[model samples]
Target: MASVNTLPGMAPTLAGKTAYVAICGLGMAADLADGLEAAGARVAIITDDTSCFASRSGVEAAFAAVAERVGPADLVVHAAASRALCGAQKLTSFGEAGFRCADTALRATLYALQAAHGQMAGRGGAIVVLGPAMSLVGASNLVPLVTATEGQRALVKSGARQWGRCGITVNWLAAVSELFAAELAGMDPGGPELGEACALGRRPQWAMDIAPVLAFLGSDAGRSITGASINMDGGEWMTP
Candidate 1:
């Protein structure tokens, strides 16, 4: 997919920062990586053997392999998520799949936070966790995925509360389904129109829309922001 241009008012100012992005294989991941790089942040991609989120040791090992490269990372974005989309009946028929999906999404996030926390223990830094916008607006055939994404949001909040004293901030970013090909394919054809569903009245620009948010969260500008869920779906789901 072609990379979208950075949005107006979003410039590259993360010159000496290092960002470690886990493997999610989504267009958003690539876009965020590109945006971070464009902002002058040294970007490191960690994709070696991170698929097995069920194994904590395995996940830790994967992060450990790139430990040196991720030294004191200024930003750690956990975009890796299981894309298993199934109907509610399918969830009941094969409960294991649901468990696996949750395990993959939640554990991978926990592991990433652990690794990033260790690196940013003394110093302050930002960690961004990506979730699907459907998690907030309950789409059909997406219970497992929604559970996992919403659970990760809770994790981000708890981590933010606990790690704030250590000068570490944790936040969640909810992106539209366009970023995830699988989720997009499974979306209901008769669903509400994007413009009608979102207050902004337009589909989101996956890369262009999310890159600046990631950059801001990873920069000092977002230091005071923690335990917050920033919706990147153009006001698709509002939270009071």
Candidate 2:
């Protein structure tokens, strides 16, 4: 359980906001929800069911029902991912298994983004998704999942460009795959850093490394920042 230790007067507070976390496979999102709550947003986690994220309509229906049950959201977050890793051709040989690993993540991202647009239309809000750093530096034999994550990055730009007119900010948060228990997909945990020594010489902690960034994105401070990939991997993965 995540504790409710909200900062009284914070700059990035989502005070008076409702953050709808359209969770898929990001390990329950409990702590992340706590961070949103700390920022003063009432957090509602929806849809861990695979079927709910299987298609665009499924995502839309879930969002619609949630809105009716609760209310429209001021922000939406989708950080769907998998811990599994595989080779490209091997996945291809396995058929849907490989594609599922890749397709599911990207498709769910699209579903959440599409549903969020409808839910926050006219009112305006923010949408954020997690994309693996593997999108930049491909992981060994981890092509399918990497493809999906990189596709998500492109979609972030696409969504932001189109939705900016609607007062919506869409951005991608870049993270090391290890954060999602992607041990094989990320830098080897027990060995030296994969490429170069980490500038920070450590991995990112969910609270210390990631939540603050999410808090800022959910706050007024991040309203104008959109369509960009913000790296939060403890300096292990840096991009220009």
Candidate 2: which stretches are off by over 4 Å?
A: 1-12, 82-96, 182-196
Off by over 4 Å in 1: 1-6, 25-27, 48-51, 84-89, 181-185, 189-196
49-141, model 1: which lDDT tens digit per residue? 444544557656666666665555888888656654333334576468877766677777887788778778898899999877767766556
lDDT tens digits, residues 1-240, model 2?
223353333334777888887877656376677767766677777756633587889888888877876688888878765444333344456477767777878888888899999988998899988765656776655667677888888998999999999999998888755565443443354432233456787866554456567767867788999998988766776776
Please list all clashing residue pairs in model 1, or write none if there are none: none
Angstrom error at residue 151, model 1: 0.7
Number of backbone-clashing residue pairs for each candidate, in the order shown: 0, 0
Please give the lDDT score for candidate 1.
Answer: 0.71
Best by lDDT: 2
TM-score on alpha carbons, each prediction: 0.85, 0.84
